[model samples]
Target: MSLENNKIFASVLTAGILLMASGFAAKSLYHPKDLEENAFKIEVSDSGVEVASAGAEEPSIEPISALLATADVAAGESGFKKCASCHTIESGGSNKVGPALWDIVGRGRAAVDGFSYSDALQGMSSEAWDYEALNEFLAKPKDYAPGTKMGFAGLKKVEDRANLIAYMRMQSDSPAALPQ
Candidate 1:
């Protein structure tokens, strides 16, 4: 193998070993139930398959098998169903395997009250959830906030994202979304 490929392979192997040794479940570390908790966005295709997008545009997608409009609360709730595994929807509620969704709309990364956070997520500047920032994070969870403990690929339906954001907004006091 080329030197670069070897280096890449070595890096991946080391990471895998370290993560495995830490005793963190693969789903928690690498397949976070909710990338949305990390403040990401979503995209959609005509067939309703999730796709990633650059800007937070509501792409045309078929109705969710349970059809959701991604840019609003109702749809967000529908989209958030995917994230229920790691997070909670109640505001000011205790942290789950991840954190609570209450009031996270304008909250910053790793801003939850008592949950243990990865250094990478905490290293981020204190900010709140907003449109653009959420979009970037949702497009690529790990890319948006490097070292974030979340491990979901992200929502791929723009309408779903919008709907989800809307729902998240209702969970918090702030009407406008903030960015971290």
Candidate 2:
């Protein structure tokens, strides 16, 4: 090889060797064979607890029927601010990142005009919006409808979900009657 080519090749070879040596040295130094376990344990009890067995499904949260009685529409409207970025709750509103949510509480899933829904959500078109379903869905949209395109992480609070549903119920001219 020419003198310049030889020098370049030597430099490349040295770099590769140094990189490999550094990785090997870091691996040995960070995790020695004689390292002690540093994890802490917290004791738990099963008394009066409904613990699911391994490989068994855990129980879903209680129905939203109970929460509806105490639902605060004002609180729900405030909570909906997070959703406003993607959806417009105003009647006759145009679709944004998500479908306008006017009358959504009683509307069929994926029934919005002009807005395209993910296949995961479209598959649930047979179901109408109801308190329990809305509750479960708002708790975790992705978990409720796997593969859904909604980017929301979901509201973790039951009161928030109830309030949001209440606010949604108010958006409709003839809102579906609330569940007892």
Candidate 3:
């Protein structure tokens, strides 16, 4: 490697070591004074991400739609309520703040008409909203499609994401789950 590359690599290594050391010191210093309150932790799931308490004993809260087809449709539509502000639900509806939601499930990114999309989103080449891509997008829209206009923080609840996906699928003409 070049000398410049070595310098960059060393700087990154030093920063990582410093950060990890600081985190360990902070944990040791605060773990005792910190209250034993449980907080949510994030984890990756087969479909998307799931959250659970750091140390609390609780039953599994896997989204109902993740396993139950009937529940998925309900959750999906209900979840879309949060997204209605920027998107219109009607098929072929005029663009809202964002592109129209018509037939988006199996459609390619940046494929909408009339509406001006961010180069960030319009630049994406993802062919369509497949399950895996959709899950990641919903998990964190801004991150998955960086520079996209979506400002959603993400659905913290697995069920909410699953349900929302179910709802979107139904909205698409692609013969998704029949209306619940």
C-alpha TM-score for every candidate: 0.55, 0.71, 0.57
| lDDT digits (tens) for residues 1-180 of candidate 3 | 999999999999999999999999999888555657658655767868575557977543343334436446776777788889889877768888978877776678888878888877777755776655666778778877777878778876666667777777777666444323
Candidate 3 local distance difference test against the native: 0.72
Which candidate has the highest lDDT of all? 2
RMSD of each: 21.2, 8.1, 16.5
Candidate 1, residues 34-144, lDDT tens digits: the string is: 554546556678978897556878643333223222345555677878888888877567777888878765578777778888887777747666565665566668767
Error of 1 at 16 (Å): 39
**Candidate 1: which stretches are off by over 4 Å?**
1-70, 177-180
In model 2, the Cα lDDT at residue 16 comes to 100
Return the lDDT, model 2, position 81.
97
Q: Indicate which candidate wins on TM-score.
A: 2
- Clash total of candidate 2: 0
After superposing candidate 3 on the true structure, give the runs of residues whose Cα lies further than 4 Å from its correct spot: 1-71, 176-180
Which has the better lDDT: candidate 1, or candidate 2?
Answer: 2
Ten-residue segment with the worst summed lDDT in candidate 2? 41-50
